[model samples]
Target chain A: MLWNLPGIHVPADPLYPGAPPFLTNTFLLTIVGSILIIALMLFVGRNPKQVPGKLQNLVEWVFEQFLNLCEQVAGPERGRKFFPWVLTIFLFVLFANWWEVIPGIETIGFKSTDTALSPACAHVGSQGFLLFGQYSNCITPFFRPPSTDLNFTIALSIVTVVMTQVYGFVVLGFRLQIGRYLVFNQGIMGFIVGLFELLLEAMRLISLSFRLFGNLFAGDVLLVVISFISIGVGAIPFYFLEIFVGFIQAFVFAFLTLLFFTLGTTPHGHEAHEEEHLAETAHAEHERVASALAGAKLEEAHAQ
Target chain B: MAEHEPHNTQNSRGGGSNPYQGALVAFSLVGQVGLMISLGALLGVFAGLFVDSKLHTTPIATIIGLLLGLAAGIYGVFRLISTFRKAG
Candidate 1:
């Protein structure tokens, strides 16, 4: 089942040509998805609407949702500024996500070499890869969801992490960004904690990248497994569940990016108002002690 | 969303010229896949443990499955990273 499944090949043909191992059926979907998104947006918003019809209205709604999401997850200030990025990401991701259901990815590709880049054994199966070229020319699945491809998801994740860091610097500045993990005030304790924070910063790159990939890839594998395990009716519910998961995973990725952006840009000590109060109290105590000692000396001199 | 229009025009090389940007994007894609596999392996281990308890064996079976899953996930991550480095 695993060998005959949808994404077993990177070249799907490993040999048909001197193809790179990175190319696969799943990647075909991602490439098409990106194009589809661009095309859809161009077609839908070609004209500015005063009142707006159904498609226009829907596009506007999604746009509004992404903006609000940015504001909610990021502050209103950054949200307004980053709205473009968040919206583009969501739209591109959403399109990539829903593309698999478009009906051509599985049964529509051409019969090439059946490796990771290809699907099903070319010579043995019933017309392997039906819709495109011999090995992934511009002729593969007219549409494959980008998210299904591990490579595509990882690509998206990496960009997202980079964007987050870029925005962090924009808001915090370089010195402040470094200060977030290089504090020297608390002496050795601060140094240790700072090192931990730095490590976490590096870990964020891995964690963010993997979380999205994990969800999307798992969904893809689940669908393949379910389809293979039971075809007539048993797989129906799982398919529906996969649809729900696809949307949720996309939402989670964008939302988390919003979250990381907010957290990353914020100054560290700003949250600890109580510490400032304590310092003020200590200063007042020193002043009171000094005044009392001066008063005592004056009293002793007068008495003498 | 409207802001995207301006940026798109700026980035529209339209010919896949920005190899560096492409490499970063490709690296990210690999990260996500490795993560998914790692997660899947973790879940598999958990499932194996649940079944193992009934069979009177300890967590050995689950641990083995988990280790295998981790190996696969890590292998995927390395593959993606190496590719990114080569392309870069």
Candidate 2:
């Protein structure tokens, strides 16, 4: 079944003495995911062909679909610019999440002698084999899904939010982008609103990170519990669900990133123009009402 | 709006109006709004704690931070809603 939740604790024993304990199972899994992606890319790029092989065809199809999605979300110009980053994120996240469904991912690892579970409670039984002196349920998993880790998700979010700001500055210029955070024109009210905008910007990091971390971690736990309850058959449907969820989450993350990029790159003047248009409409409505009232008053006078 | 016209046309061509995509967009917006509010408050609390520690004002700074956080949360929700509306 499941070991103690990975990344909940920094392993006391380092992979090598004098090394930091931060090299966690999730970190290892992230490395694995990266390697897999690199290998796939290398395989696809090793030989060029006028016509494509199955693998190349699959890769090309994915690329085309994702590029189309980016174009839809961010226009052709920005979409082409953002295509690589968004695609990389989507592929990495999707692969990382799918790693969880691999058999024995969090189940198989070296047993540790420093377990929190008591020896008496850790005996093998009809339910399942229990190894003593290991972490939760006496099993130390070697790899866990990287997306389940907050650090991984947070790093991705930082990249996203930081790049968004960078693009904003590149498109709108520094003063205008910074103006988004430090509004000063409308006196105290504008200043207050600016502070809120600033806070909201900061909160994007948490939002992006927590959404990925929460979903993957919860799914991992759910799978473990389900498997523990019913060993094989019952867990199959859940695995399929996780697979679907993994794809959806990856798409959502990429789509949201594209959306943020589009929003960020848009000049503040556009919003101001919309506001002006709204004001103009309101004024026109007022004028129409006033004219109607005036005509009604003139008719009453003429009747008198 | 002129710039976005091509993008809109592309989306229409690609069947972007599918109910599933609409649901996903809605879900993303709602989740983002919720996270922004909670995290804003949490960040404010941390900021307040740091300020209190530095200034020895204790709960006053924390209370002010909490209020500011609430305002920020509400503003964030409005901004997100407007952004999605504009995008859609």
Interface RMSD for each candidate model? 14.4, 2.9
Question: Candidate 1: which stretches are off by over 4 Å?
Answer: A1-16, A21-23, A112-144, A270-304, B1-88
The Cα error of candidate 1 at residue A158, in Å, is: 2.1
Residue A135 C-alpha lDDT in model 2: 35
User: Which regions of candidate 2 fall more than 4 Å away from where they truly are?
Assistant: A1-19, A45-57, A120-136, A269-271, A274-304, B1-19, B45-63
Estimate, for each residue in A20-62, the C-alpha lDDT of model 1 and write its tens digit.
6756556665567678788888988798689988988888767
User: Given candidate 1, what's the lDDT at residue A215?
Assistant: 69
* Top DockQ hit: 2
Each model's TM-score for chain A is 0.73, 0.79
Quote the lDDT for A57 in model 1: 82
Quality of candidate 2's docking, in CAPRI categories?
acceptable
Clashing pairs in 2: none
Instruction: For model 1, state the Cα shift of residue A251 in Å.
Output: 0.6
